[model samples]
Structure formats: structure tokens, C-alpha cells
Target: ALLDIPCYKILMGCDGKNLQETKDLYNLTDAEQELLESKRRGHALFIIGSKRLHVNFEIPAYKFSYMGKAGGR
Candidate 1:
């Protein structure tokens, strides 16, 4: 099943590769990196923030395991 959120939010993360460049440019807080690393290997991390809460969604490893799997991706 797919997870549904109620409202809109801003998501942030390191764009992988050139970690140093991303850090220098974005200046992400410790909390952000901490949150990203919380996910297991082979997981897609979504860092969502809004008026009420901040959250991370670690997508399942297999695309078929979730609903609306991306563009046969």
C-alpha cells in the first residue's frame, strides 16, 4: 500500500555524489543528515517538512511492493 500525507511540504537531501559540494552549497542541518541515514540500504528517502511536522519516508526496496510504482521504473 502507498502512504498518504495530508498536506504539502518541502523536502531536502544530499543529491548523492560530491557529498562535499552538496554540503558546502546546501549547509543541511545535522538533523537532516541524521534523518536520511535512518533509512535502510536500497531505500528512497523523502524528507518532508511543513507547518506541523517533519518526516522521512523510506520507500520499500522493491518497486512492485508499493502502489503506483514509478513509470515502470
Candidate 2:
């Protein structure tokens, strides 16, 4: 199900317990796996291809935006 969407940055969960799942999803290296285990709370990897960036964000792009005033029904 998660394989369909085109994602720019994928948030990799910080845990070695789920090592295989994480590896399959992100294709993490040995160094990356070590780093993943060292992550503290409120930190995660922003996976962009082979590059593992720090900042993580989710897609489907839902956020507050200013629209015109609503007309009374």
C-alpha cells in the first residue's frame, strides 16, 4: 500500500528491533543502521535515495491555507 505514492523524503523510524523492515524500506547501509540506533527522541532520518538527510517530513501535503471568506448558505 505504501509503495504506490511517490515520496521525496521518507521518515525512517529509529529502532534496530525492526531492522529488516527499515532496511527494506530505506535500503540503509551498515553506518546508517548504526546511526539509526543512536537517534534520540524527536529525531529521524529524511531518506532521499541513497542520501540520508536529517530533516524529516510527510507527504499528502495537508496544511492550513487561507481561502476566501465563505458565503452564508
Candidate 3:
């Protein structure tokens, strides 16, 4: 989807060769890949063309109320 999709995307744990596997996506410098790795669990990468933008996600300060009845037919 990386090659075909034209909208903004958020990726996590998709550094190094994973970016290369996208084919059209260019190589990230060692420093860039390491930055992605360092932020692993807390951040995501937004790949727009050959540019990889780092974005820190903020979860809303509210919780989901119980939806209840999981798997109810």
C-alpha cells in the first residue's frame, strides 16, 4: 500500500529494511532508522515519498466506556 497509497500514513516498528522492502520508498539513513527505533513504542513514522516524518501520538484524556457484550451474536 505504501507505493500506491497517496494519503498520509503512520507506521510503527517499520524501520531499516522494512522501509526498503517498500521498493519505491528510498533508503533511510542509519541515524533516521535509529531514531525510529529509539521511539519504538511511543512514536510512529509518517512516510511521505522519500521523507520520513516522526510524529508523537497523544492519546485523548478520556477512556472508552464499556461497549459491553463482546461476541454477542
User: What is candidate 1's lDDT per residue for 19-68, written digit by digit as tens?
Assistant: 44534433556665554445434333343442323444556668546755
How close is each model in CA RMSD to the real structure? 8.6, 9.1, 5.3
Q: Report the lDDT tens digits of candidate 3 across residue range 1-73.
A: 5455776656666645665564335455666566666656558767776577878777553522343456433
Ranking by lDDT: 3, 2, 1
Q: Which should have the higher TM-score, number 2 or number 3?
A: 3
How would the candidate models be sorted by TM-score, starting from the highest? 3, 2, 1
**Per-residue lDDT tens digits of candidate 2, residues 1-73?**
4642545655545665576677676677787676567764445666655566765344333432233246432
Off by over 4 Å in 3: 1-4, 14-25, 64-73
TM for candidate 3 is: 0.49
Estimate every model's Cα lDDT from 0 to 1.
Answer: 0.45, 0.58, 0.60
TM-score of 1: 0.31
Give every collision pair in model 3.
none
Write down the TM-score of every candidate. 0.31, 0.48, 0.49
Task: Quote the lDDT for 24 in model 1.
Answer: 49
Candidate 1 residue pairs in clash (backbone atoms < 3 Å): none
Worst 10 residues of 3 by lDDT: 63-72
